[model samples]
Target: MAENGALLRVENLVKSFDGLRAVNNCTLEVRKGCLTGLIGPNGAGKTTLFNLITGFLKPTSGRIHFNGERIDGLPPHLTFRKGIVRTFQVPRELKSMTVLENLMLVPSDQAGERIWNPWLFGFRVSRQERQIYDKALQILEFVDLQHLRDEYASSLSSGQKKLLELARTLMCDPQLILLDEPGAGVNPALMKRLVERLELLCHELGITFFVIEHDMDLITRLCNPVIVMSNGEVIAEGSPEEIKGDERVLEAYLGGQYLAGT
Candidate 1:
């Protein structure tokens, strides 16, 4: 809905911590339905930028627009309601809850959540809860977590937890998902499944993804028109092959080894 066909856009955005500028006059866009990659070295402000976009951190200046509406400085819950959702690098699962329960908790304002409604409108509340439960089961099946629906989140492996995180986001029916270091701590076998699921979500389900990852191989395989950030600024935007051959990108992050492989 944004002008120029960008689903989300940041203009001259800045975030400062004391005297340090973590994100300095940065700007970018995530086109609708694209699997966009954001790659940068440590201290390059990639996470800081995500924090700003998701309303976890307030920007000091500039503007953020989602679907053609200004959303800078909105609270995290407000952003979530606007169909922008984000996942942490380390999955934030409720360890004591069952996988199904974890997914069920994501949708806001269920009729059964109100005490009076549950007591006065018992039939309505029961029906609403059944609907939510059915949707949670379908999402678990999509992410291959249906088999663990009754298992406590604490019992799952690191990779499964990551999958659980993705399943939880689906409950919100988000328009765009910001994934931070999704490949981190995931084994190669699990990583392949994750990639396939992400692809299906983007292509088949019309969900857009903006991902930050350190794994070049994963970025190369999954993303198009990759965005490179260095010192809190985007220096290049290109295809996987173009990014690999870029001299500035090589010097700033990718380096000679990446070029050699290319």
Candidate 2:
């Protein structure tokens, strides 16, 4: 049920490793300013699709577009620069760095990265660093992690690490974000926090999210026009209620997965 005017588009996309097709003829749309959810059974090509969209893997065939520009075959860093970024299921924060430091590191074109820039434009670099730190503090506060800004990422719980990862992603100021199983190990309370933060970001910041989530309740509560996949292809797309009731989905997944959480 993909509609027109999508901010992200996947058209006849395919990926293969050796002789096996991991993603086959996948086509979908992610509209701007929506919190889209992608749900599928294991080996449904969810992560493979994410990798292709994020440019971590070159597609075996087909095309991808973001913000009206072709993005397929671009490198991951180039894709990120085009305002599409992704977060992993396991939070990838730097263990030794403070939460605020982690966020500061995500922004690109930093003045401190080059060797000569430090001496030639040290004052400008310091000013830029200060600005980034201030913004990082604001983002940490927005995600309700300001108090933990100075804490090492390693010391945080599984849930807090996820929160930190989300906050860091914000530093990049992406227009579209692809998230892989954000609630995998989070507790209920922190999961609620993550959802609330995501809602606020979506509405207020106008950030678009395409997430892979296994928690039925979470997806049903947060997403609309939910998309379901099976055998590396999209099999169903509709409201959460409609998807949960789809006969095709039931036959392929929901019938057995209904009792299991993901």
Candidate 3:
């Protein structure tokens, strides 16, 4: 945990489908302004847990608190408005839109979105649109995508798309961002850049991150208080060094035979 207080807490989180539990009584907490890692082998219910926290899926039983307020049953949009945002393993971009347009669309509260705004006050709507455009460009610059701001999202490479997705997440000014496999399909060079940007965002922008990543090296370098899960339950929680040397973690990552030899 960081010196700051707990920003989010999960208590006895449980989720099941067809009588088979995908997430089993998992409990964890994310410290404010800290980077946390969530790791597990295949079928460990990592994504399911994310879905539950982000309100994409409802839990069978559990509680989630953000800034001391209960948020378990809130819808995704409400959770987002409350300063929790999540990115997918695959970048979800509007292929037909420009990168800048994509960023502009991320802000949840749009004044012009109402049907009456244009008809009642066209001038005000235009001014607000310009402001949104300028903000979008600034965010693109922050993500180092300013040069491609006008290009269609479909034209971007996978790494660029991932960066765009991260940029879009920032438009909301999120307090806690949940990244699901940010490096899954990204190239090594761009992956390194992504890690650096994430570090800067936490250190400079004061944003908290709860990352779900399989890349142990990336997790070790970027996150503290790593959480390890196996068979839908948290098996260990500690610093990178402790997790690396843990017997249960090794068993979860490598199988019992390898752990026995170790």
Candidate 4:
């Protein structure tokens, strides 16, 4: 049953590509202000499910509701405007742009981009740019990337790029963030910082997160009521402890290992 205060709801969702089901008959609800985890082995349709919910791929059937309103068939940008945003496994920063410039570009409301802005509104654009700059710097400091603010995004380390992506997402003032393997390829030292920042975002900013991760340690530490998928459908959902001990989950992970390496 969908909770009354649920922030996201999916009912009997289905998606197919070339007559092959990528996500099959899925139904779930993400409660308001909760950190939820979606986990599975490789090719488990985890990313496919995320793409469906975020509007990267349209569902073949079923319904999606966000904040009690139907949002199926909406484009990705419209979904983003509705306070839903997603991060990629690899950070998508402009290599040539400075870190601050990258963050400054995340917010979509740009007055100067309009054709009439230059002639009709000179100082307004300047004021808005200054305000955006200030906010971008504040976000940089928040992510502990202030020292690298002026550096080319390409020059930063992989972990720093991930942080920059998170900073850019924050610029949108999102209500829900769908994270795709946030800790993947990050170093241990910076990975800790990433975890801390996510926790703070949930606790302080009241943002909801639905994360897809392979790192069981990260999932155990940060997520609750974890949802597991395999073969294009949800297999199980429970707390970290329960999931760890689940026979089906063990089979999903260890069964192949036993056959391949034994």
Native-referenced Cα lDDT, model 4:
0.87
What lDDT score belongs to each candidate, Candidate 1 first? 0.90, 0.87, 0.88, 0.87
Candidate 2: list runs displaced more than 4 Å: 1-3, 257-262
TM-scores across all candidates?
Answer: 0.96, 0.94, 0.93, 0.93
Stretches of candidate 1 above 4 Å error?
A: 258-262
lDDT of 3 by residue, 1-262 (tens): 3224889998899999998889999989999889999988888999998899889999999999889888997889889999999998888899999998898887577778898989998999899889888888888888789999889999999889989989999988899999988878788888888999999999998999999988787888899989998999999999988887888998888764333332
Candidate 2, residue 11: how far the Cα is off, in Å:
0.3
Candidate 4 local lDDT, 1-262, one digit each (tens): 2358789998999999898888889988888788999988888888888888889999999999999889887889989999999988878899999999999888586898787897889999999889889999999998899999999999999888888888998998999999989888888888898889999999888999999988888888899989888888888899988877777877888663521321
Model 1, TM vs. native:
0.96
- For all candidates, what are the clash counts? 0, 0, 0, 0
Error of 3 at 180 (Å): 0.3
Over 194-247, each residue of candidate 2 has an lDDT whose tens digit, in order, gives 889899889998999998998888898788769998899999999988888788
- Against the correct fold, how does model 2 do in TM-score? 0.94
Question: Who is ahead in TM-score, 2 or 4?
Answer: 2
lDDT of 2 at 23: 94
Error of 4 at 106 (Å): 1.2
Candidates 1 and 4 compared: the better one by lDDT is 1
Order the candidates by lDDT, highest first — what do you get?
1, 3, 2, 4
Clashing pairs in 2: none
TM-score, predicted candidate 3 vs. hidden true structure: 0.93
